[model samples]
Target: MKTFEARLKPLMIAGLDGEAQAWRAFLQLLRPALHAYFNRRQFQGDADVEDLVQDALLAIHAKRETWRRADPVTSWCFTIARYKLIDHLRKSGRAKLVPLVDDHVLLNDGVEDGAVRQDLAKLLEATPPRQRRLIEDVKLSGYSLAEAGERLGMTEGAAKVSLHRAMKTLMKRVADREH
Candidate 1:
């Protein structure tokens, strides 16, 4: 796949820019390097790794203007990424070095549960756009019915109806999985 950076470089250079896309491209470019750094430093926990990556990306975007044009973008990105990783580790007290586990035990039953969760995520992704948005806003993100309705440009009653329908659909899908 052609990268966002590769596809959009000319536009960026011309100052006909996509700062958000540029940030996304920068994160994609930095992923491997960040992963290697975390692996080498023995960072554990999927949630921790994802949070660190997200925080680093946010900082990189915020500080993008400070990065020197003369310096290589990779180096600049890694520097910020590394600092973010270290900061998260320090704040969370999850930095203690432990002997690495080559293989971790997973309960045999967990495989089915994991598959169900994956399917649920996909099902949600495939949901009708408006209902999906409403469910995410009201249920997943804990937005109040009024708040969700306001954001979705609907009356609160309408939002509640839409959300109930969305949840019923999801429940039906999950229930069908058993059979």
Candidate 2:
């Protein structure tokens, strides 16, 4: 009996060579492995696991030309599966990375704190005075939108729009700085 890798290698090679039947068979063979792969990682449910598997298979098919014959097919397939799993986690809003240190500890570090403050000040400076005040009151000061709006003498809806525009401007500035 052939090992799973051995069984998959020929099919992958054939699939890459444009054999439609071989590609279909390769995907079929990969389904169970993909399911098991996702299950072991504690995917939300069977449905989620199946969805991830199907996504992985489709990605594998689409990116087939990028796979090198010199590499083990299993490694290539699992790499795609891992990427799909990560994407699913991100899309589902479950990809947060917990910090090792507490917020208090981070704040006390004092390293580059001044620089960070200066950078933020510069970013905030790019916005108009009213939008900047709204962001500071609502986002930095942790006030509710309604409270911020009342404090700024504007309706909550107007405050929200101003904050959104301010945030968009700040994001563009940050992206520009990075480049």
Candidate 3:
């Protein structure tokens, strides 16, 4: 089964090589995840979220040549999205200073960004690679279970069951960590 990076990187390369279909497919695959990211961060309305997604896409298109072939495309795309989010927040005066961090943002979300990162990193490290990938692909990357399952060569039911178990395991691990 191919990892997300494994699957996405090639399409990105083909897009760079002027494959119009692959380029559109690559952006289409990314739209859901980028939309989810902005939605979770701020909620001006659906239009605002859509604006952010389009903004990120345009930025990605403009900066397409800057991406190093050896680096992770997802990381590069999210970096651009994050900057766009920060810019939006600043312009709206909702956030004066938003620190760039991983997994969680430094917002009014009660959980400190550092703590969220620590807990997330710990839980992710404890999960098996397949389960970890499921979590990342489905939950974080906004892919449906069926979509993620197809990528991993599993049935949707199997993917759903595995993700359920993964969440349970993380809950238990979090409880044990608290103890």
Supply every candidate's count of residue pairs whose N, Cα or C atoms clash at under 3 angstroms.
0, 0, 0
Q: Write the per-residue lDDT of candidate 2 for residues 10-107, one digit (tens) a residue.
A: 99999889898998999998888788767767766799998998898889889999988976677678767766766787788885432211234234
lDDT winner: 3
- Between 1 and 2, whose TM-score is larger? 2
Candidate 2: clashing pairs of residues: none
lDDT per model, in order?
Answer: 0.60, 0.74, 0.77
Q: Estimate each model's TM-score.
A: 0.41, 0.52, 0.55
Name the best candidate (by TM-score).
3
Can you write out model 3's per-residue Cα lDDT over 35-76, one digit (the tens) per residue? 887777658699989999999999999999999998778767
What lDDT does model 2 reach?
0.74
Model 2 residue 67 CA deviation (Å) reads 0.7
Between prediction 2 and prediction 3, which has the larger TM-score? 3
The count of residue-pair clashes in candidate 1 stands at 0
